[model samples]
Target: MRKLYVIGIGAGDPDQVTMQAVKAMRRAEAFFVIGKGDQKRELVEVRTAILAEHVEGPARVIEIADPPRDRAPADYTEVVRDWHERRAELLEAAFDQVEGTGAILVWGDPALYDSTLRMVEHVLARGRSAFDYEVIPGVTSVAALAARHRMVLHRIGEPVHVTTGRRLREEGLGEGSTVVMLDGDCSFTEVPGDDVRIWWGAYLGMPDETLIEGPLREVEKEIVTRRAELRAAKGWIMDIYLLRAAEVRHAES
Candidate 1:
């Protein structure tokens, strides 16, 4: 039976790649890359740089064109389910090509907001392939954001909620701190309330990294404008933000 390694390469910074992740990469015969396409070609370049910097010796890199999906659909869950199925099919084909060891390097920890693991499970459930696999964790953008901001995720004893932008917009802010990811719209602006404090970061761990922290209303416009500028200039942006009620900060103080 063949083997597969799903390794987290960290959010953006190459140094965030752990020694464990390095070991996993060295073990693989071919690294399966999900092509991010031209607009985000810099993303692909970053991945290649990681391979070049750590994986020493010539390594085979297999590029898999990512399947398209509906970014916005009435049934978000069903659309995503279909997209995962399509991804599973492509991965299954790639896994079949590697005779021994193969891998897929994921950004952030596989457990958090990443679908690579689900796609791998889907391939196995399809009953067409059988391969033992392992997951090697890496630093997440959430951690990167916290470290860059030099602050903890939440006030002592309070729970922190991590969610997507769409969910944040729909559900509003919950108790404690709310960390939002995958928000195409600076949903932070929609979070409501001048009392909410926000700490936001984009291109985390990379050279273009940006950070903004202030009362939600005070900096929401700055975040939106900066985010737009970054996106327009670079053609893409990856960001995450943490929001806390003003009273919570006072309590911590």
Candidate 2:
């Protein structure tokens, strides 16, 4: 391929797609899709639907089967590095089969907790194939979560820390407010203190979207229960949440 576009479509909602993303999608002759296995076929469907709704004609889609990796790894960094290398191999081979401008649609933004951009870089660093690439930014799940809850991220002039569930478990909450992602364990339950409040959301934009909010101690159990039930029903789940120390004064405007 002569060129590629790494586009972020948004958290989940089709309406979240921006005009910049639409333009980038139109410019590409084919799309290289990755990581949509049987368990999450609906994810690829959402991307396909986005293309159908925005593009002038039918768009070409190329599916690349993802290599399996250890989900619960003893050494997280090394395992993830090896997995990305494997993914880069697949992406390189897939790109070679197709010609002309192509794009890879990424969930959420490519910068946060997604590996598409890294794998793309890996493909180029191998020097096997060369293609100029551009990134199209889209609304992030963090933004979507904040919007859904109708709340600001932090108090006046305070910081908002964005972290993973594992890190939250290890480091505990940071100053000001905390937004946790990629948390499968419901780490909010691990957060100490009854003074914390939480606003959580799942399936941010899709039809089955769910939201819950209240003091952490009071609603943590409910959030955990609902998360399990949703995952059981759908076989997959994507969720994010914000936690704040309730004792932090709500400064007067």
Candidate 3:
């Protein structure tokens, strides 16, 4: 049976790739990379950089275009499920043409909000079982962000909540510790600036990365403009941030 190695190549910088992930890339017979259309070509470029830098053996790199998600709002869950099925079909077709150990380089850690693992599971459930798979963990952007800001993600006895920007906007910031990811818009504005402190980082682990922290009300505008400018210049951006209620610190004191 062919082996499938799903390696997390970290968020952006090539150096962030774990030694184990690098070994897997070199050992694999084939590498399958996901291309997110023309707009997000940088995603594939990052993966290619890792291959060029790490893979030394006779491994072939194949590019597979990711299927666009259906955005029409007719039952969000169903739309996502259907989209995953389509993606699985494309992956299966690519797998059919390749043999030996196949590898995929995932952005950030596969365990942290990444869909590559779920897609692999979908492939297995489709009754096309011919390979054994393993996931190699990578350094997550959240960890990098926190390190850059020099802040602990959670208090010793407090709960830490991980959520997306959309939920942060719709549901508002939760009371306990919270970390937000995949937030394109300035969702931090949704929370009352007076009551929270934010530690934010963008393009983390990359050379041009930026970090900003302070009471939200004081730095919110600056972060918004800086993020917009950075995104416009790079054509893409990945960011993560932490928000804590002011009361939490007061209670600890």
Candidate 4:
């Protein structure tokens, strides 16, 4: 039987990695990092930096190219399912080759809208399981964004709704809830500017970080411009934000 630990390396910064995550990495026999093509090579590089800084045991780091998603059809859900299946297959093969503790470094906390947990579940569903899998949580980008902006994501008694950029664009911002994790797409423009305030941060916890906070209508253009500039400069960016209605804050007070 083999043991596997799925550790969250947090968003961008190596210092954001939890001590438990580091302990897991140091104990693992092999570390597996996912590479999402060249555009996101920094993702793998960040994980490598953490390993180099913390891992003390004799562990081998392995980098695997993530399978391509069929995005041409634009069926997001279907494409993601296919991609997860392919990833699970690759992970299973890697596990078979390595004995002792195997580790997979995940971005941000595993439980917070991350798919690594789901992929691990898929591996377990195969019923050929011989590994005791564990998940180590880390600081989420949402937390980092909130802290960087010095804003409370949710007001007292008001719910905070964490959603993706697509949902924000499609359904618009929800009433009395704070929306976090808008991955690109400038979805903030969909909200009625008069009603909401946006605290947006790109590359949170990194040196190239950019943060903009103001009424959505006022800062929408600024956020868009800055995001575009940062992305173009670095070839990539990972951003998250919190959108809260002005009324929600006043009501809580």
Candidate 5:
């Protein structure tokens, strides 16, 4: 049976690639790339640069076109489920083509917002492919954000809440620090509070990396404008932010 390695390639910086991830990459006979199309071509290049820098031996790269997903859906979970099912089918086909160790390089960590691991499980659940798989973790964007900002995720002994921008908008702020990801809409703007401080970063770990930190009310508009300009210039953007309500932090302390 062929083996598959799901390796995390860090958030955006090529240097963030771990030695363990490099070892896994070297073992793979072919690297399975899930293409995100032309908009995210920079990401594709980052993956390629990792392989070029770490994998010294001959390796084949197989590109798998990602299944289209609904950008906005009334039933988000259902749309995602359908997209995953379609993705799993494509992965099954790609896996069937390889005979030796295969790999899928995931952005950030596979355990985070990424769905590659789930798709891999879906492929196996179909009973069509037989292969053992392993996950090599990488530094997540959240960690990169903290490191870049020189701040902790949460106050002493408090739980850190990691969530999507949509969820943050719906659920409002929790008791502890909240880290928001996949928020294309700048959901932080919807979070109501004058005392909240936001540490926001985009294209983290890469050359175009940008960071903004200030009272949410003061910097929210700047973030929105900057994000728009960045996206318009690059055609795509991947950003994450940590929103800390000063009142909550003071109360918890």
Candidate 6:
């Protein structure tokens, strides 16, 4: 059986590539680069840079175009499931073509919001491709946000709820702090609280990185404007933010 290594290349920074990830990259004969369209061309360049800097031996890069996904579906879960099946088909076809060790470089940690691991497993479940694979964890964007801001994710011993923008809108903020990802709508604006503070970062770990931190009411408009400008300038943007009541703000101020 051939082997596959699903490595996390970290969020937006080539330096975030771990030693373990480097070793895996060196061992692989080919890497599968998932395409996120032309708007995110910078992300692909970042992966290429990582391979160039670390991989001592020769490695082949296989670009795989991602299947189309419904941007606004009434049934999100079902739509995602169908999209994953299509993606698994593509991955299986690519894996079948490769004879030696292959890899897939995922952004952030695979265990987080990413769907690569699930797609890999789906391909295996079909009994079409058999390959032993290992996971190499990397720094998540959440970590990058905290490190860049020099702030903790939550207040003293409080639990942090990591969720998506959709959920944050539907469920409201939980106890402690809320770290929101996959939010295209700047859902923080709809979070329904004036006393909250937001620590937001966009293009984290990249040259165009931007950060905003202040009371929600004071900085919400600024964040919205900056986010739109950044997105328009770059053609794409990925951002994450932490939201909680202004307890910490009150204490510090």
Give candidate 4 regions above 4 Å deviation.
Answer: 57-59, 72-74, 248-253
Task: Tell me how far candidate 4 lies from the true structure as C-alpha RMSD in angstroms.
Answer: 2.5
Compared with the true structure, all predictions reach lDDT values of: 0.92, 0.93, 0.84, 0.81, 0.92, 0.92
On a 0 to 100 scale, what is the lDDT of residue 11 in model 1?
91
Task: Indicate the worst ten consecutive residues by lDDT in candidate 5.
Answer: 244-253
Local accuracy of candidate 5 as per-residue lDDT tens digits, 1-253: 7899999999888999999999999999999999989998888888888898998865688889998988899999999999999999999998888998999999999999999999999999999889999999999999999999999898887889999999998999877899999998899989987899999999999999999999999999999999999999999999999998875324565
For every model shown, the clashing-pair count is 0, 0, 0, 0, 0, 0
TM-score of each: 0.97, 0.96, 0.92, 0.92, 0.96, 0.96
User: Which residue ranges in model 1 land beyond 4 Å of their true spot?
Assistant: 248-253
Per-residue alpha-carbon lDDT of candidate 2 for residues 68-124, written as tens digits (9 for 90 to 100) = 999899999999999999999999998887788989999889988889999999999
Q: For model 1, how does the per-residue alpha-carbon lDDT over 1-253 read when each residue is reduced to its tens digit?
A: 7999999999999999999999999988999989878888888788889999988788798888888888889999999999999999999998888899998989889999999999999999999999999999989999999999999999878899999999998999989999999999898888778798999999999999999998988889899999999999999999999999965334555
Which tens-of-lDDT digit does each residue in 1-253 have in candidate 4? 7899989887778899888988898889898888888998877877877888998744598787888876445788888887888888778777887878899999888889877877877788887667889989888888888788887777767777889888887777776666657466887787776867888888877778888888888888988998888889889888888887767334565
RMSD of each predicted structure: 2.1, 2.1, 2.1, 2.5, 1.8, 2.6
Where is model 6 more than 4 Å wrong at Cα? 248-253
Question: Sorted by lDDT, highest first, which candidate order results?
Answer: 2, 5, 1, 6, 3, 4
What stretches of model 3 exceed 4 Å from their correct place?
57-59, 71-74, 249-253
